[model samples]
Structures are given as C-alpha cells and as structure tokens.
Target: MALMITDECINCDVCEPECPNHAISMGEEYYQIEPSKCTECVGHFDEPQCAMLCPVACIPVNPAHVETRETLMQKYVRLTQTAA
Candidate 1:
C-alpha cells in the first residue's frame, strides 16, 4: 500500500526529500504522497523512507490505495524503467 501523510503532519519538510520515489510533495496544507509513485520502498530500501523519516509519525499506509508487495515491486520497476 502507498503511504499517506495525515493532517498530523507538521510540515517539517523532511519526508518529501526522504521519499525514494519522489512521491511525496507539498500539498496546499501539508505534504501529500502520490499513490501512483509510491512503492513503499520495495525497490530501494527495506522500509518506506518518508515514514521512517517523518518526525511526527504522520505517515501511514493508505488503506484506500491498498496493494500487495508484488504489486508495489512492479510499480517500482516500471518507475525505474521509465526513469532510465
């Protein structure tokens, strides 16, 4: 599942840079994670960078965009391939 930034986010600006997939961005009121680009760090790290780095623990799995580990890996591969 893609991780989501909740309203509890302090806008500390740390999570955005930590996201390996460039999925996190500054939204109108806080940080937002793009579901399409979020891979839960399956291809780049052992865990989600943004969630691990978020000081307030505002990042959580987006239940609305639920996906399996294999699916996330597939998305990561597609993203990397497109970037290459």
Candidate 2:
C-alpha cells in the first residue's frame, strides 16, 4: 500500500528528502504523499524510508490506495522506466 502523511505531522521536513520515489511533498497545511508515485520503497528499500525516518511517526499506509507487494514493484518498475 502507498503511505500517507497524517495531520499529526510536525512538518519537521525529514520525510520529504528521504522518499526514494519523491512522492512526498509539502501540502497546504502539511506533507502529502502522492499515491500514484508512492511504492513504499518496494523496489528501492526493504522499508518505506519516509515512514521509517519520520520522527513523529505520522506516515501510515494509505487505506484508500491499498496494494500488494507485487503491484508496488510493478509501479516502481514503471516509475523507473519512465525516469530513464
């Protein structure tokens, strides 16, 4: 599943740069995760970098964008291919 930044976020800015897929961004009030670009580090790291590094533990799985590991890997491949 993709991850989401909750309102509990302190906006400490630690999560943004750590996301390998560049899915996190500053929203109107806090950070937001773009579901389409979020693969939870499936192809890049064993854990989601943003979630793992968030000091406040505000990042959580996006229930609305639930997906399997294989699906996430497919998304990762597509993203990388597009970037290339």
Candidate 3:
C-alpha cells in the first residue's frame, strides 16, 4: 500500500529529503504524500522513509490505495525509468 500524511503533520519539511521517490510535498498547513509516487520504500529502502522520518508519525498506510509488493516494485521502476 502507498503511504499518506495525516492532519497531524507539521509541515516541517524534514520528511521530504528522506524520501527516495520524492513523493512528499508541502500542503497548505501540513505535508502531503503523492499516492502515485509512494512505493512504501520497496525499491530504495528496507522500510518507508517518510514514516521513518516523520516526527509526529503522521505517515500512515494508504488504505484507499492498496497495492501489492509486485505492483509497488513495478511502479517504482516506472517512476525511476528515464528516457533513452
């Protein structure tokens, strides 16, 4: 599953750089996670980076966008792929 930022987020900008997929972004008052780009750290780390770095632990699994490991890995590859 992808990850999401909760209303508890402080928009400290600490989690942004920790994400390898660049999925974290600032919102009007809190940080947000792009579900399309969130891989749950499948390709780049042993665990979810945003959740790891979140001071308030606002990062949570996106129940609305459930995805299997295979799907997440495929998306990771697609996201990192570059033009030839």
Off by over 4 Å in 3: none
Sort every candidate by lDDT, greatest first. Answer: 2, 1, 3
The pairs that clash in candidate 2 are none
Local distance difference test, candidate 3 = 0.88
Best by TM-score: 2
Predicted candidate 1 versus true structure: per-residue lDDT over 13-32, tens digit per residue: 99888788999889999999
- Candidate 3 local lDDT, 1-84, one digit each (tens): 999999988888889989888888887888888999999999899899778878889888999999999999999899989412
Error of 2 at 28 (Å): 0.1
Query: Lowest summed lDDT over 10 consecutive residues: which window, candidate 1?
Result: 15-24
How high is the CA lDDT of each candidate model? 0.93, 0.95, 0.88
Each candidate's clash count: 0, 0, 0
